[model samples]
Target: MKILICLSNVPDTTTKAKFVNDNTAFDTTGVQWIINPWDELALTRAIELKTDAANTIENITVITVGGKDAEPTMRKALAIGADDAVRIDVEPKDAYFVAAQIAEYLKSNPFDLIFSGIESADYNGSAVGGMVAEFLNAPSVSAVSGLNIEGGQVKITRDIDGGQEEVSVEMPAVLTVQKGIAKEPMIAAMRGIMMARKKPLNVVAPVEVEALTEIVNFEMPQPKPACKMIEPENVKELVDLLQNEAKVI
Candidate 1:
């Protein structure tokens, strides 16, 4: 089985986000980038799955849509245990463009299983995995929290309204993994890091796809208001606040 995992390089969660180009583009100045947390989970889980299957999986290839600036993150994914990497040479415009680039890359090189995060941390669009499945005309499972492979079939558990649902499907399917699908991401060991330098990092030109959306502006949310304390005996006041001031009631 050949497995393909989609990854993204994103600003660390601790980084202070800023926008440039009249607030229409993210500013990368002085920002530290890392493999997106959700994508890391997907990669780690794919590694675990491959290992546990007694070498049923032949290779685990990680792919991304970005320029050379994103190569560091790709190497990090390789260090985490992917067999190889593919970097589509292009500026990642949006979720649609990214997914289209990946789908286009997969046209000639298909895999038995495809893994991606439900959404990227920076955009939180939650759209790419499903869009890639649509572009490839393949069955897709989203928000997957549990995965198991038996024989040639794949079973997945996902979150649903008020509960969870389990589904099984054949090979050549796409999955959008969620956080709990795997344990905390493993730190890349020194040996793995060294081995990653020798691993293949193939670069390919992106296939043509017109962008469907554009960012008009970016704005940070307003600072939250300070909390107000109410005395225990002021029940009526608390009720009034809930009914009028907070308006939650």
Candidate 2:
């Protein structure tokens, strides 16, 4: 099987977020970048599928849409077990443009399966994976929690209203994995790290696409209000306050 895993680089969870250019752009200075946590699940699962004895994966290719700064994150995916990496050298301005670039690349080379995270942490827009699937004319399942390959079909379990639903689709499909799909992806070990340095990483220019959205401005949310304290002895007063001021019975 030849699997393609779509990866993304994002700000580390601990990094402080700020805006620049009068709040028109994100302030990237002093920010540490890492692979998106949700993508890690898809990456790890792809590696597992490739290495499985029952259904061996012939190749696992990891691809990303970003500039040179994204190479390290792509290398990390290789160190974790992806066979090779490809980076579309471009600044991802919007999800639609990114999906278009990926779809254009995928048009030349077909893959048995494609994987991506349910949503990016920074944007929280869960649209790219499905858009890419649509562009490729492939079946797509989003926010999947479980996946298995059997009888040349991909079986996926996704969260529903209160439970989970399982669906099966044939090969040449796309899936966006949720958090609970697998355990946290492991970091690169010494041997894997050394091996990654020699792995193939191909860089290509991004395909052109007209952007559909533009960021007008950004502002931080207002600070939370201070807490209020009520004395235990003032039961009647509290009840009256709740009835009149608080408005909760």
Alpha carbon deviation, residue 156, candidate 2 (Å): 1.0
* lDDT minimum window of 10 residues, candidate 2: 48-57
Which lDDT tens digits does candidate 2 get at residues 68-167? Answer: 9999899898899888999999999899999999999999988988888989978888888898999999998887999877755677898977999998
Please identify model 2 stretches exceeding 4 Å from their true place. 229-249
My TM-score estimates for the predictions, one after another, are 0.93, 0.92
Q: After superposition, how far is residue 47 of candidate 1 from its true place, in Å?
A: 0.8
The reply for model 1, stretches above 4 Å from the true place, is 53-55, 230-240
Query: What overall lDDT goes with each candidate model?
Result: 0.90, 0.87
